[model samples]
Target: MEHDESLRFEVLGPLRATLGQSELDLGFPQQRALLALLLVRAGRPVPAGEIVAALWPEGAPASAMNIVRRYVGSLRRLLEPGLPPRAPGRRLSRGADGYRLETAEDEVDLLRFRGLTRRAKREAATGRPEPALRHFVEALDQWRGPVAAGIPSPARDHAVFAEIERELVRTTVMAADAALLCGTPEHVLPHLGRAARLDPLNESLHARNVLALAACGRQAEALAAYESVRRLLVRELGVAPGAELTAAHTRVLRQEVRSAPRKRDLARPAQLPPEPKQFTGRQAELDSLRTAADSSAVLLTGMPGIGKTTLAVRWAHEAAERYPDGQLHMNLRGFDPLNAPLTAEAALRFLLPVLGVPGHRLPSGPDALAGLYRTLLSGRRMLLLLDDAFDTEQVRALLPASPGCLTLITSRRGLSGLVAAGARPLPLDLPSTADALAVLARHIGRERPAADPAAAQEIVAHCGRLPLALAVVAARAASHPGLPLAAVAAELRRSQGSLDALGDVRTAFAASYRHLPDDAARLLRLLSVGCGPDLTADAAAALADLSVRAARRLLDELADAHLVDESAPGRYTAHALLRVFAAELDRRP
Candidate 1:
């Protein structure tokens, strides 16, 4: 409601700005184009020359500067109604070489859309489906039509249009994924359907649509959707539908349904796996989890190999005795390389049997299974550990609608979605130097590290104090006790330029990197070339040749993925080994 009074700028559908209950007239076509350009580069200065080029791509007259100045004055007056004729413009300040539109983050719809999407992504990663679902829906709803519509310029050209459209399709697909996880795939069908019509060649959307259709029990419609995509791909690109779509079609053809078991058949399940032998550090995080023992859900998240699962299991093992009934554990495998994440239906199928319900008597659909799972857990005191979750939707379906139970989740993502659903988040960080040394000692022996303190410290620091990396180094040291601690440290330094020699570190880091979109991945590779131990957002922008705002957004994304650290705002640093890995990736042709 507060946003209603603030100035609202729209670019997804049209070029329009409004204040409160009235629409502000933004002037003629060229004038609107000028406004659109400024809005696109909001919070940053746009040089007069750049503006002139964008306004008239064919050519610009000698009076372009004068025309741009006049347009700026008019926009300033419209944006800040109280400003005097000659008074320095408050909203649109004139810089030495350009003008900048100073506006709040939420004033522009595009900015709001990005903010919402980032939050939704964090939530999904954190395993809070309800809020992730809400945020994704809100973010996707911002796209009314083509970006910068009705503007005549490069802004409306296919090149610019493609970028915005790609982002829109990506968001739509992600929202649909969340919906499916929340047992409401039907809600995203219409949006996905419209997107599929616009992007006929996007096999990913088509595959998801088929899955959604099948999930909703419309097997015929699902097959038809597949056929439609197959025909379109063949006609437009002279190729068949890809494997993902083909698999969806195959699944629909073999669809089978089941029903939930009677309450009498419900069984108490204790299925927690073994905790890591060398679990170290995380005293603070473990304490936080202990404090939230009464909370219905607690989500533990961090970057890949930060030991999210280790901490979750450690805490679960510590708390196992409190829940007398039993414990339930499942690895959702959200980031599995060979297999896609387990769906809510599949998860329930695995879980129901553990809870005493036989496979034959389990519910036929995800929604039904979720309902039955909740019904069975209503009054039971139990522990549910949902590990390696892909997003909030998958976690949501698996949550018991019970106050007496506690659900613990581990993920490589932040999972901001869980916060709205009353999940307490415990983001795990790399271990302290002391903890890393202790872990090494646990693996080998404290005698070697204790004999030479400085060399031992250097070894852990080179590993970035990450438990997994430290474990690898420790294992190597254990295999050759004759080798000095400094030798291992020297090996890490010598191999800093290459990641392959680091052992499965490549596989661990690549799993997280492979999930990023093309641009994000490219930016990371670029950062690897330009980066030192640490760099500010401005440095990143200069290295990548992107606008400051754009670089900052990308940096924030990298930080969220745990590829970089933003311990100090605006400054980013990557782990020593991660930087090497990124650099190695960029070197590939």
Candidate 2:
């Protein structure tokens, strides 16, 4: 947080003292702007006219140099309160050409980050992925926020620093990819996930996720990762999955080779799928998915009915075109109690033929089938969408070794093991306020009684912005045209009487709850007995008759289920519908 140290400044966040770590309170706007300009031109001299132009883009005072000198003098005095008496010619000198902000290379974090990234890139180019990843991670760790957070300058050089920040992200991703290639997907997943989240729109990260996932034996999960990326690209940018991603997906589904025979040859082209009928919010979640997709594979993970399947389906449809060979979609009923989760062998038995492998020739053992699957995809491009994966074992049997393929996997579990194998983790939650309202408007029509702007807002808010709840409320409103939004909101507020009226309304929350561990399920039901805005770890623990640590762990588990939202760092809250669902579950059995 310290901004004052040496002459060099770090502008990634709020302009802070990077040199001495001594905070210099530059009171005036002009003074802050002036320091920003110099920081951009660190280790170099900036001409006086350039400084004037930077400060005053349109015009400058005739005595700009004098004014500039005065500001510089003030900065020097402020920065160096008690300097040693100048030797012969050392009195903050100015010459005919321009003024210089004298500083060492070590004075700036930006400079340090850039230096490290550059080294990492060089190492990667030389095939030293391990060292490269290390340097890249070290450089990225220096960033606290956006580049030049509170400072803005009209100078072109300032823009260069902005680009550098972006490049830093690119470099960080490259380093993480290198680490994955160097044989440690698990080690790099956290770093890759963090970087991808920061830059969700980047396609390269999504591809990286696919690679990582396959490498870690989560092929089905890898396919799900691809679907998530495709959805984000379509929803956020209205763009289809790029050729690279489609080809990668194809490679995975077809079990393509790790490296293509012709290194420079692009994957075969594919056709894009139709766009979704209604797309609302989920900007942040989409970004997170995109980030995960940047890896070789990702697990689109969350509790049931939190739209994991919707997101996966949407992404698959959008990304279909990328895999010209074909888009292979499958669901492994890992969580269905009536039918046991499909084994790797059985799932492959169904998928291999869709991928063009003959049933008569398919391998018998899970490992053999997976090997054949990879062999089939070695040289081609394909996309695979694996939904409702049960565990790492089932998913691992389906992964292809080809780096050219993309895979997207969805699961209720956290699946950190998939992450260890380089699968990006795209965690899902409830819809945002805007998205929830849109869902209601879609289901009930914009002119419904509950569709009044204020009422609609209250309905969505009361529904906790959960998609299922929004859909149900909208359905109810549509069925009863004259029902007031206030009435629906009030009905939702009453837990005991709401369930029967809800009927199948509780289905989504029930599905999510069904997946929870016994202890977590018990705790969720217990916590539902309380009524409040949010629950801190302590409160939740007390409700569940657990110690704080145990309670916190349980709350986090609930969060993974998408039944509880982590409202703050250690605070949790259930959606209105989820609360009702839990209360009903508590009364059951």
Candidate 3:
């Protein structure tokens, strides 16, 4: 037989096996289940009756034996293709009582993961935590995603996988603890952050996280992390924090914990990125933000590339002195095309240290981290700019628990869901002609637009009066001082069919478009192909061949996502750049 003896099997995230350079196909749900059941008990024969029970626990059919035999034959063919027909299977061989999968321990990813975890634990117990920490990292890195992500049932609930997953979590916490003991807790904060989410109710992990945070000199956040555990325990389990957690909280309160040295500690973080040099107009939106200043949170939602971040950053700088503690800024990267939206836990991991938690002392779980964040900000007046939010759930976990901090969140969608959380939504629209002209004047010389006033007005109109589009036009004009405003306007008008002159406009719109639900995405494409300047529900229905009721619901979704504007009741129209991007999608083969 030509089968590779070094065949590898995996059950970490999915059921997969590969030999040499080729991936072996594990066919059919039942056949795959049978293979998983046997592999978990490799080197020991699993009875035919046991196999049937594991694969179909409810009951077994009369032809269950025949089915198992047939599946075994199929799996054997794939596992050892060069074997002659009817030849005794070498990899999967029938025994006197049942069958056994002849595989070595090192050939399986699960075995390797478990082995590293055991070694890490042994090293930690021997007071050699640094080595333990390295093994712990290697063990945790084996997990590709959730356990048996898309595999059929029973295999997921199998005893081996469940035990290993539990072990992985414990190992992760152990590694963090080892790092803490070695005075290098800062190195394992990311791992602890992930494990804490996986096992939120684990009090030992929470205590360890708090200690690490305190060790980083973020005493305020450490105290808050303990309080988070106390509240969660009471709210969910109807109990108080255990002895260790209480001790950690008390130590943080008294400032007696030994914290790691700070390389560059700041009195307060002023992390806000620079705003546009010459921001123009949005007087009305700025006014609304001033009104919402007293509110705990304010959401500024609008279409793609519509100056949401610019407006928020500008206002943050303008009101910098109002927040005496400091300013915090994070681009949630929610609408980023290349990267996944930042999760609440990951965001807290980054923000907590800046707020004063020592790198080693940051909370491990999102809830705990958020609690620590809130505790640190409880009495301090701070400004938090959470830019490019994806949805309410993403925003909810990141909101400060205290009202002393004011959060400014921006999203490409309307985020109506945030209204329930006391967030006042201020939806932004295309800039007015006057405001658009001012933006152009700010970029190009004011005298240039004033010289050819008619052409400048036509340019803003053609760009749909969007600040982003207007800025694109202004940039092209600014690069060539000798170029006339009329010529720049002509280029914008001529390039309407393509995004060559739009400058990141299509890329921005595509980022939001990809996040839409399937029905909304399809409707967006159809609207580009068939809809008009202003479409009523009835007209939209005819264009997409959907019922009026269905079309209205889709339009409402589109409106929520800021993909289209509801000019009046049941009337929708997309921005010029958005329409161009959508039309481009429709033309795709």
Candidate 4:
């Protein structure tokens, strides 16, 4: 009955509340995150543990529950001023489980978004395209950015938020479909573009974009759109366009006619693995890869389990557009525990067929195969990801001659020989604290880490920012959502650099060790008990009781193999996880 709106809330982007025309400050980050969580639940009672967990992602304080109580009271006072201390709130209510924000569907932007989306779908299903398109656009307008954008990064990245984002993508995709059906393709272009950017590899979304462009009479743009996603799928996912996307391409080319001569595409293999899900961190390295996208080859070298292959694949997918001919991948299996390093001959044998060479018609021997391989790629622009190469010689036979091609290689070894021949060496080191947390967030779950930030930091610090270690910790924590990160950190601390807590990262280190020369292997074990953190070449001589020359030579060998890092001019350091691994080997005798 009131002309002035009494209350309104927004959770489509940053959490917000408004009384009449004025916006209310949501107080600090914790308070804002709290409100956002409740709004996401949408009037359903959130449990106390869930609230406490989400509010203090790093870990709740000793007085965390009390702080939550106080924050709620303050929020209530802010929402309904001039109320008595013990009075119940009309909008914010406490229930048996925890708390909930009571608001009508019209009073919250997200609720309105959901309502409009349902109505839109219903409208379209019932033969009402015009109104359906309107509902879709109206629903999409609710989002300003990522949901709960201004809150804690973990909360902003929570699974619930990710689901909301997925819903947005679905809606955007549907909106584009609706626009074309109703003959208003131009109207949905902006939303379609936004959704496409959010999920560049989504074939369905890109398919709709292509069709919509064609529907609007921009055939050239539509064809380019098709090629873009086609290349994206080929290079990033290692698969050609699925039926839906290919059908869309077919529709665009024919322009509502029965048929046209199908365009011929050269047989190009899309051999890349699926893009890694929730790949976190490594921005600096990703940027470096971007800058070096024009280069013929880039090497990602680091200790075992440092995520070199993951980074290579992640970048390959991102850089796929540049190489429309195709993408090819080979796991050299350089450090596989159960198998020998894939021979260059075997690698060539595997790769030739993937490049469209017939297996029976393939030439025998590495030289002939390598030659044919180079000739096949000579004129084409392509992307090659040679994963887990053992040595320089192992990959040299596999390098292509085309300047138009880019090769990405991942190995634990530095592959100095390849570097001398012009491979841009990108040594993937430990992730930054922020990126480490992001990695944890990506693997485990964002909400838990956000709840106990200190515990999250402890886990990162204890894991030494190694993506592999973080992933292990994340896997454990993720399996048990209610397990406090502090408990995880405490468990890692108790392991005392033992592999018992870090999962199969120890197994990964063992592969590199198994392939090490005897002298270098012994030196690695002795140094774990030697003055740790690092050792000079001369100091290594006294510790191992070998000549300084022998220790120095073995040290360099170890350094080249990446069992130990060359921390300075002549000094070397072992990673904590590696140190533990070495100690385990030392104790075994």
TM-score leader: 3
- Candidate 2 local lDDT, 1-589, one digit each (tens): 6554455467656676533645677656666767766766676777777778877776787887677777777767666667544321232345676766655556777778778888988865544455676787787777776666665445433555557656756765676566454444555565556656767888887777676666566789889988988899999999998976787687678764232112133233332234556555677876666555545576898755667777776776765566556666677887765567899899879876665554654534675466445545554557777888878888976765556567889887777778888887788866767677777877777676344677777777666676766666677878987888778877766644356655555754565567778999898888667648898888977777889999888888877656677888987887666677777777777
Task: Go through the candidates in order and give each one's C-alpha lDDT.
Answer: 0.80, 0.68, 0.79, 0.83
Q: Candidate 3: where is the Cα deviation over 4 Å?
A: 1-266
List TM-scores for all candidates, in order.
Answer: 0.56, 0.50, 0.57, 0.55
- What does candidate 4 score on TM? 0.55
What is candidate 3's TM-score against the reference? 0.57
> Who is ahead in lDDT, 1 or 2?
1
lDDT of 2 at 586: 74
Candidate achieving higher lDDT, 2 or 4: 4
lDDT of 1 by residue, 1-589 (tens): 3545568898877889998878999997888888887877789998887888878888889998899888888888898888899787778888796888887778888788888999988866655555676898888778787688888856456354567778889988888777665556777887788789778889889887887887677878888888888888889889987787787677667663222343456676778889778777779888899998989999887877778888888999999999977999999988776678899889988887887766754535676577557656756789999998888898988887667789999877766787788998878778877888898898989899998888899888777887778878888899999999988888887877886555667777888888887877888888678557788878988888888898888888777777788878778888777887888988899
lDDT of 4 by residue, 1-589 (tens): 6666478888877778998888999898988888888888877988888888777677779998898888788888888877789788887889898898887899889999999999999866644455678999999999877688889886676678888888999999988766654456788888888888878988889988887787677889989988988888888889999998898888777665111111132377788899999797788999999999878999999888889988899999988888998999999999999999999999989887676555654544576466556656665799999999999989998887677889999998888999999999998788888998998888876788888899999999888888888888888888998788899999988998579887678889889999998888999998778595789888899999999899899999998888888888998998887888888889995
Task: Rank candidates by TM-score, best first.
Answer: 3, 1, 4, 2
Instruction: Please report, as a residue range, the 10-residue window in candidate 1 with the lowest summed lDDT.
Output: 256-265
Report how far residue 471 has shifted in candidate 1, in Å.
Answer: 0.7
Residue runs of model 2 more than 4 Å from their true location after superposition:
1-275, 287-294, 449-451, 478-497, 536-541
Better of 1 and 4 by lDDT: 4
